[model samples]
Structures are given as C-alpha cells and as structure tokens.
Target chain A: MDMGKGVGLVETKYITVASHPHELTLESGQHFGPVEVAYETYGELNQRGDNCIIVPHALTGEAHVAGRHTPEDRVAGWWDELIGPGRALDTNKYFVVAANVIGGCCGTTGPKSTNPETGKPYGADFPLITIRDMVQVQYLLLKNLGIRRIKAVIGGSMGGMQVLEWALMYPEMVEAIVPIAASGRLAAQCIAFNAVQREAITGDSDFKGGHYYPGPGPIRGMGLARQIATITYKSDESWASKFGRTFSSIRPQDYYSLDNRFEVEHYLDYQGEKLVQRFDANTYLYLTKAMDLHDLGRGRGEYREVFSRFRGKVLSIGVSSDFLYPKYYQEEIHHFFKQAGADSHYWELISPYGHDAFLIEFKKMSLKIAQFMQTLS
Target chain B: MDMGKGVGLVETKYITVASHPHELTLESGQHFGPVEVAYETYGELNQRGDNCIIVPHALTGEAHVAGRHTPEDRVAGWWDELIGPGRALDTNKYFVVAANVIGGCCGTTGPKSTNPETGKPYGADFPLITIRDMVQVQYLLLKNLGIRRIKAVIGGSMGGMQVLEWALMYPEMVEAIVPIAASGRLAAQCIAFNAVQREAITGDSDFKGGHYYPGPGPIRGMGLARQIATITYKSDESWASKFGRTFSSIRPQDYYSLDNRFEVEHYLDYQGEKLVQRFDANTYLYLTKAMDLHDLGRGRGEYREVFSRFRGKVLSIGVSSDFLYPKYYQEEIHHFFKQAGADSHYWELISPYGHDAFLIEFKKMSLKIAQFMQTLS
Candidate 1:
C-alpha cells in the first residue's frame, strides 16, 4: 500500500483509498464504525520515507489546505502561502500531507455522513469523540498508507492540539512537532466560551436538540455564536483599526429602520454566514467539547509525566495577542519539554490578529515553522 | 407661581405626579398632546432664590435620583452622594431637583403612560422627542417652581446632555453647569450600541412593536439588550477585576441541566433580570432614539455657533475609560466652548468603571462639581 505521490500541484491519484471499514470507539463508550478518512498529498516520499509532514486542521477546516492544480478544484487552498513552492514548508522540498479529521463535515465520516445501519445521515447519533480518538483514527489512516512515521507534524490552535496528541501517542513515529497558539489544557474561560456557543445553538427555538438537521438547527444562534467567537479570535486593536465606529457609505432608502450599515457589523455578518454555510452545527459542538476535554496530562497525572511520554523534539509557537491561549501557555509546555530533556524550541510570533494569528500572519509563522523543520533535517 | 421654601432638606418634597401631561407644538410641524414629566425635589428654596441646583438623571434613571424618605420608597437614589447634608451639593446648602424625562417609565409621561384620549398606554404612539424637548420640559418645571434662575445645574451622561441643553436654551437661568461623562452629540459608536439594543428587543417574537402592553413585550429580548448594554457600561478590565472566571464553590446540584453555574454567567443573568423588572420595553426604544438624535447643533448648524449660545459657566467632566463617550468627545465640546469664548472648564476623571464611572465615582465627581460651583459663587 505504497500510496505516495511525487511533488507537484497535488492533482495525482494519491487520494483514492480502497473502500474499508475503520472503527473509532469514542470517549462516551459508544462506537463509531466504518469511518472514511479523506486526505491529499504533495511532494515526493524519500527512499527512506523520512521527509513527511502531517498537517492537521482545526474545527471546520477541510483537507483542502493547499493547491489549485485541477480546473475543477481551481480554488486556492486554505493555507496556500505556507504550503506552496518556495514558501515556508516548501512543497518542492518536503512531502506534505493533510487529511480531513474524522467526525468532520469535510468529506470525512461525521454526523452528516450516511450510517450503514440506517441509510440516513448519522445526525445526533454519532458517538462523541475526543482529540485522542481523532488522533487514533489519523494514525490508522497513516498506517493504511504504508507510512510508518512522520518527519514532523505542524498545526496551530486545535491543529496544534492534534500535533501534541500525535507526539504523545506515537512517540517514535513523530520526529518533531510544532504546536502553535495552543495550550496544554483548555482554560476555564475557553470552556466557558464553548459552553456559551453550545447554549446559543441549543437555545434557539428551531434547534430541537441535534435533531433539527433535516431543517435548520439554530442557524441564527449558530451565527450569533460565530459572531461572538470572531470577536475573541481577533484583537481589540484590529477591530478599532479596521471598523472603529465607521458605517458603510451604502444606505438603504429607509434608513430609519434598524439595520447594520457599519463595516464591522457587515464583517461579522459575513464571517458568521460563511461559517454557518461551511460548518456543521453538531461537529462544532463535538469538536469544541474535544478541545475542552484536551489536557495532555489528564490521566497521566502531571504535565512533566505527559511530556515525558513524547520522545519527539518539540517546536512550539505562541502569538503575542492570543488571549484565548496566551504565550504563557506555550512557555509552560516549553518548560515541560525542557524539563523532560526533549530537544525542544519555543518561539512567540508577535501578531495583532490574536488567536487567529497563525492563519492571518502566515508569512511570519511560516518562516519560523520552516526554519525549525530545516534544523530538524 | 413662586413655589419656594426655606433652604433645608425638610422643606423639600418628593413630588410624584404619576403621569403629569402638558400639550406642546413641535418645530417639526407636529402637534403632540399632553406630554407628562415625572419629577422630585430636595432642600429648600430661599426668597432671593439664588440657591437652586438642578440634578439631571442619566439614561434609564428616573426622578428618584436622590434619597426617598418613605420606607416603601426608601431605595437610595442613584446619586445619593451629592444630595445629603454637608455633602458636595449639600441639601442644606442648595435646593436640588431631579426629573424623569418625557419618555421614561417611572412616574413620567412615557410609552407606558396612559393616553388621555384613549385610556391606553401611549406605547409607540408617543411622538419622538429631542434632548432639546426634554430641556424645554425641565425649563417649564423650573418656571413652575417660581425659580427665575438656577445657581448650578449638574448631571452625567444623558444628564450631561440635558445640562448642555439647559446652558444653551436658558443661559441666564443657569449660572453654572457641570456636564459629566457626556458629549454634545452621541458618537457613531454610541448610536451603533443603541441600535443593537433596540434590535435585541424588536428581534424577539413577543415584541408586538410597543403594543405588547396587553401582555408583555419580550422580557428575554429586553434582558439580552440589558446584558449587552451592561457590558459596554463597564470596561473589560472591570469585569476581569470583579469576576474574572469563578464558579460558585457549591454548585446548585439541582441545576445539572442547562442554566449556568459560573459567577460571570450568574452576574449577567442577574443584571438582565433586574433591568427587565423596572424598565418598559417601549420606553427603552423611545429614550434611546432620543439619545441617538441628541446633537446639540443638528439644526443650529456648526458646533461653535450652537455652543456660543451658552453664556453660562460650564464645568465639563469626562471619564478616562468611558468608551461609550470617550474623553475625546468632551475635548471636542471643550474646544467648541473655548472657540466660542464661553465661560467653560473641562475636567477628565480617571476611573476604571468606564461610562458607569459617573454613578460609581459620584463622590469624586460631586467634589469636582461642588468646588467648581463654589468658584462661581
């Protein structure tokens, strides 16, 4: 099963996997069976098969993290700048892989996918999964591809959570890991944000629990949640700079009625609407819960003990303005890595984008991740 | 018409006329009938009548801005600090007066007030009023008291707006004016906040467009609006300082379902519930609209020209952390006052309470106003 392809625009037949059933037992004791993992690949696998990178995404992100080679898929990838030729990760140099995480809306087995038991969408019956469970499924995906190990794993925020999980769960398999804008455990504030987001969805009259799938399950509530979350993701300074008290020049004939004509309000509406269109509501609930439950040292006791499990070199990055998971959190992980005697490096990316800094300030973040990987080489 | 008593608190009376109406013709080619103003008084008026101090209430404040003697009405006034004996605007020293604006819930002519024509609450039928109109009513109240002139007029936020109007509309009547945490005109952001608040109420299904008096007009929506407004009233710094992220020690074991357990969540719920209890939804709409339309120079043209009309001594105080109406707004007014060659002074109060700083830091503000008034004397 040497399902590997050479470096190019990633239009190769690398994504086709023989139809197979992969079971994922969740944290809630219920089992999710026959999962399909959709992935894409770039760059050549070396003869030794060592130069490989697994790019895990945050919630609602698709496997289309790069490229626009195919005419049908001409749309640019979510991370085109960081993953393309001569830039950061440099697809011309290293084999980069990105897979839609299990229990995702993006081509992966999720609530939206058909359940074999009943020919309908899994809907609310989908078993709740933890970050570790998602990682285990990813591990299985890699195993099926005849890939024994990864040279490095790079991701930020929830992506970073996956990287941490990968490093700890498969110590020998991961040579290096970069976790950006991530924390060892979700803070109470982070959990609170999630709780509110969940409540917004559940609070809506249209939302009959998770059963309002055939119709709309609290789209407005979900939009409101995203609007609130968007506020937290960006810095206050950014909002002040861009939209500070300025209304759009465009005016409706009846301006007396309550309507959002401000640039910031429009911006929030766009963000909220786009999110609602692309993201499944149930997946948001499940993934947020995963992030909340994620503490590398949960059963392992202390952080040192958790770090001790990871034999891989750690390269962690934090954003200066990311109040959600501040720089202190990355520093704590760095200290643990150092104490655990791992070849660890820590860096802080000074960006005003806050928690979304990794996504927005890609040029700076890419250089740092590339440099760290080059050092590993 | 000379309604005067000796200069003492005992001589002052808490005048409560539930729906005192007076008909008036508007400059907008509109004739509105029987508008009511709820009001209260403190201290005694001298025969010479040069000791009156009109204390305007802030947004959402009623005529009960000072102490209520009766046990049933014993709730301390919003600004009790400035009204007591030997205090800043000492009741023993000055005759104090406060009034519920035309479009208010408490004993004033508002949406909730009965329409003399139909015996139903005015509700949405209450014609729109400008801050100038509010000032006009206050002027009548003053004349009705047989007070030819006020020694000083002091107020904060919306009250400050009224104070500015008083100085402009009746320059000779006002000897000195203290406008705190306010601007000549509501800023774009301020208007935007008000718009959101109005939307929260109107967006609710239960809101029958101010005609919900038959039942109730969306208590949940009103609550949500209050929650949002409360956030703006205080700075994020204040919330972090007061209740960062703390859950009660003993969880309400019975509340295992949805309703929040976190202190911050509870705090928000309490604030929302408290506001809905006292406030009329329709009144909230009308008053906020008036606040939005409150530009002192809207029809009067340029800033300086409108401000030049004020010959009274102005003592303007702005809060450092009030993002709602920032210090820059006060500076704008101060610049106009300076440019107009008006007798004016501006003070910036440094407080972490933000817009609500005026109410919470009343003692400090009272001292500043008292000292300024004494200088005029």
Candidate 2:
C-alpha cells in the first residue's frame, strides 16, 4: 500500500490492540475483537511529546492522510494539500498522526478483516462501534507510540466527531481541539440520508443480507449510495456553477434515450464508480451507522454539560454551505464551549462545496489552523 | 377507481386524443400516441363559457381533483381541500377541471399504456414528453369538452410547469395563471436529484430494462427513488420537529442491527412502500425526465420574451422553505412577468413543509387564490 512518490515522506504503520486474551468491548456491549489499526505519522516527537497532533480520518478516508507511498500511485493522501512541510498542518513544526477508524476498511481491522475465532470476514457479524470506540483505539495507538499529551486533535466531518470525543474523554491530554463540519449529534435529516444510503446497499439483491463478499459484491447498490452521497457533499450553488444546465457533450441520438444528459449526471456517475473501486460496501454501512449513533450527550446530560468537561482551547470551524452538518451545529459547539467558561473560537469557511468544503478549501483552512495554533501556547 | 364516501360530486372521465389515424408529436421531435387524458370537473360551465379553470396534475398526481367515486374509497383527490365550494378554486363560482398529465400512469396514456404499434405496454419505449407536450394534450382535452376559453390555468410542482406552458403556448385562451412551487426551468440541483432517482430505477436488475411490467416490477428501485424524493419534499425543520432524534419505538437487540432506528427512517420507508403500491416505475422515470426538460425559454427567446405573449394576470406562489423549488425560482418568474408588462402578484407561503407546503397548506393557498381570482375578471 505505497502511497506514491514526491508527495510526502510519511509511511503507514500498524499496531495491534485487544489481541490474545484481551477483547475490545463495543458500545453495543458486544465484545469480539483482536483489533489492528493502520496509522501514519509525520515529523519527529519532541522531548515532551506535546507537539503531537492527532488527526482522525473521516467516514471514507484512510490512514494515508498525506504523501504518496509509491511513485506509481496516482492519487495522493486525502489531505495532502494541507499536511506537508510548510503546509497548513506543517509537518516540519508538528508531529502529526492519523489512523483508520475501527470500522474503516483502509488497512484497519473492519468488516473486511478476518475474525480470529471463525477464520472468516466479520461481514454483518462485526460488532457495532461508535465514535468513542474509535477514539479509544486511537488512544491505544498513541500510547503505543509513547505519546501522552496532544498539541491538538483536529478533523472534519466523521473525523471531527472523533475529535470531539477525544477532547471530551481526555480533556487534560489534549491542549486544543478543532472540529470542522461536524455536530454534537447527527441531525434528523442527516440520519434520513444515511438511512436511505444503507437501504440502497442492503436492498440490493446481490447484498444477500451483507454476505455478498467473496463475490461481485453489491457494486450497483454501493455505486448508487455513493451517487446519493456525492450530492449532499456539494451545494446547489457549487453544482450550478460547476455543471449548470449544460448538456453532456456526448448526446444521445434519440431525445428519449436514458443516456447521461447533463454534465452533472456524468460527474456523479464518475464519483460513484471511483468510490466503488477503492471502498468496501459493508464498511460504508458500519461507519455511517456509527456516525448516526454519534451523540455526545447520549447517556450524559445536556450538550453544554457534556462539553463543559473539555478544558482545551476549542477552535470550531464550519462550512457556510454545509447542509449535512450546517453552520448552526458548529455554532452550538462554540456556544457551549464559551458558556462553559472555556477559551473557544469559531471561524466559518465561506465555500459552496457544502460539507466537502473542509476538504477542498485547504488553503483557507490551513491559514486558519496556523493562526489558531499560534495562539495555543 | 372508486373514491369513496364523504367526498365531493366530481367524477373522473377520459377522452382519447391523437388515437389511430393521428399520432401526437412531442417536443423532442418524436411522435407516439393515441393518448388518453383522464379528467374530473367540478361545478357547471357558465352561459359565457369563460368561467372554466383548468387545473393540471403534478407528477404522481391523478385526474381525481375532488370527491370519491364510491363509498369504500379511502383516499380523496389530491387537491380536494383547495378546490371544493368556498375553497381556492371555488367550485361554487368556477368550473374547475383537473386532468392527469400525458406521461402519467393515472388512467393516462403513459409508459403503462398499450403501444398501438406493438400492441404491448410502452414501458421504457414511451417517447419522451415535455411540459409543453403535456399542455398540448390537455389543450386537446379542453377543446374536446367544447371549452374554447380558460378563465385560468393553475397548478403546483410539475403541474405548475404545465401552467406556465399553457399561458405561453395558448396565451389568448387563458385569462389568468397561477404557478406554485415551480420554476420556469429546472435548476442544476433539481436535475441532479432527478438523475440519481432515474439511476436508482434503471440500475435495479429487476427493472429488466423497464420491461418489468406483467411482473413484480422494479419495486425496490422505485421504493428507493421515493425515499430519496420524500426527503426533498419536506424541509429539514419540518423533519426535525416531526421526528427529531427520537429512535423508533422498536429498538434492535444489537446496536449494530440495520433496523429503522429513527422515526424519520420509518416514515420515509412507509412513504416509499406506499408509492410502490400505486405507481409504475417506468412512469416515474418518464415524468421526472419530462420535468428535467421543463425550460420555458427553450427554443423561445428569453424568459421575458416568451412571457410577453401572455396577456393574462400572473399570480406566482412560493414556499418559504422549499429547497427543491426555492422561493428564488418563483421570484424569477414574477420578475420576468413584470418585466414583460403582465399584471402579476407574488405571494410567499410561510411554511415548514418545504415544497410540500403547496399541497399541505391549503387554507393559506385558498385565501391567496380567492383574493387573486377576485382581480382576474
């Protein structure tokens, strides 16, 4: 899994946890894991190890947060734009770490991973894991790397969910927390979208009740799910600006033909097909379900009460056009942080990319992160 | 199709047009028909014959504008609340007529109708029709009924598109026009949603190239499409207020189970299943495609130029929270209508039901329509 050349100098590494007699207990009270996590690191750990920044990957992201492992790899890391030397993350000044979450398929122990007991892929039998469970695994990974205090835990979308959990669960261990394009809990509309996506996968005849592995898999269903998701990742303004009413150059001879008519249709199809090539369908279901279960005050009290536990300097960022985790969600986090007497700040990235602005608008994000980090003593 | 008791006196009737010796030509330059339009009328034609108001059905709508055909019928006409005596259309004072659109499956010539050439169901082979084509068919139906002049043409959603077309295509015949929750042209985001829905239906293996009729049909795909559509029909605020984060009463034994955990999920599923029971998948595809092609200015110069031909009063209504056909779309229509020197009025319905407000907020709509009608004569 070489990420390619001339990208970054970081290489992915793995650590095994809950192995042997130790099993990982999930939020569902189900315990069945000898889990392994694939991670990547940049820069060098300092004497105090306080400069270590924990970067968690989003739902479809991987441990390869920056750089290319091999020259032949066409695509660089997901956050390659902001994670290199002198970049927003500035690997030169900070020790950065990113890992694939518990239910992710990118070199992590997930549904694609084989169960030691049954010697078979977990598939639908995989235990349900939550955002907190993912953070716990990353905690173990950080401990294994001999790191204790974190300079900051920053991420966007699902990754931001983990950042929130880490800051809340280990307030003293983290000095600063930045959660971008994320909310304290999944909104009803967000949950509805996720539900339809899951239905798309599960309803596929090829899914065979999530046992479609070792075959063609639910490619069509997964593609359709991706198609649905890609729409939400972008805003109406972005789509209109990028691929308006312009018909596709490849027009069908018959006006009634079901060929891709609009350029936007072709773009969505391309995105869906691209994701199907690199991602696992079952893991998509698992991760999205984990997201739907992400409520900071589930068993806790009010949101402000839960956020009060974090003493870190909070820098919450929101995307103006992000309908998935609208700006109001970020504002709530900032409001609660300030109400709790914590040092908090909020910045909105004005972009039409919607929830995906966090990924696309790297230059602006990097500038904001750099400025925020400078004030974090 | 008996519409049961406790309903108004309207009874559905059908008229065949472009049948046998005559074939209907579509906007796409393709021809195929022997089209039948199912219509229902309320009230009587006045001596002047100028009190006839044409009401066009939206996508998935029918000819039953009010009343029940039988005592056992459970579902009344879609616009029953707004078309009865003292209501919006005011059957007491106006002769209101509603007809199933040309590409509809509700007793109309559509994908489910028999293709005279093949003597089989048209299915996917149904020629693509547009808003203007649907207006043309309705025009023939109106002419057959011996109604040479229309007091007004009013509708919402796709129906609204037809209303716009009717005012433009038969300007001299229509005295007033009302288009609700609709635009002169489909936006990129709207087109994108339609494209994904079509993909959902066409991708279903069970679809068998839209030849699933006489079989189980593409029930799963159609259901998924409906699920996706139901989300756009309502606002996020509406869903949050109605369903919130409340989990379904039936909790899964395991947190990981793919059960419908949220009330919104269950609600969407119910809607999907409900639509599957009555609608044909191929017709959904055809109608959506037709909507995507609804550009009033197409082949006609600018919007103002096309609208200038109508010497009628225009009352354009918009829902405050409609994301699919936002208020801006309605504003555009009003802007152009005024620019073209037509007498026009714009009303915004304050509602949380999103695009569905036009269908659900009947009382507000009725008041507005009543006021607008007073100025029409």
- State every prediction's TM-score relative to the real structure: 0.75, 0.95
Worst ten in a row by lDDT for model 2 chain A: A1-10
lDDT of 2 by residue, B1-377 (tens): 12112236557898887775248777777776688888888888787778899988888888997877877778678888777666767777888888888878889898888877788888887877888889999888877877878999999999999999998999999999999999998888889889888888887888999887789898888999999998888877888899888887554673556453888888988999999999999889988988888888888987558878886899999999887888988998998888888998889999999998988997788778888988877
lDDT of 2 by residue, A105-198 (tens): 9998999888777887888878778898899899988888889789999999999999999988888899999999999888888888998898
Top-DockQ candidate index: 2
Angstrom error of the Cα, residue B171, model 2: value is: 1.4
Name the runs in model 1 displaced over 4 angstroms.
Answer: A1-61, A69-75, A94-104, A109-200, A229-272, A284-377, B1-31, B45-59, B72-75, B81-83, B115-119, B122-140, B146-197, B233-261, B287-376
What's the lDDT of the predicted structure labeled candidate 1?
Answer: 0.73
The parts of candidate 2 lying over 4 Å away from their true place are A1-7, A249-252, B1-7, B249-252
Q: lDDT (CA) for every model shown?
A: 0.73, 0.85
Q: Which candidate has the top score in TM-score? A: 2
The superposed Cα distance between candidate 2 and the true structure at residue A99, in angstroms, equals 0.5
Calculate DockQ per candidate and list them: 0.14, 0.64
Scored against the true structure, residue A143 in model 1 reaches a CA lDDT of 75
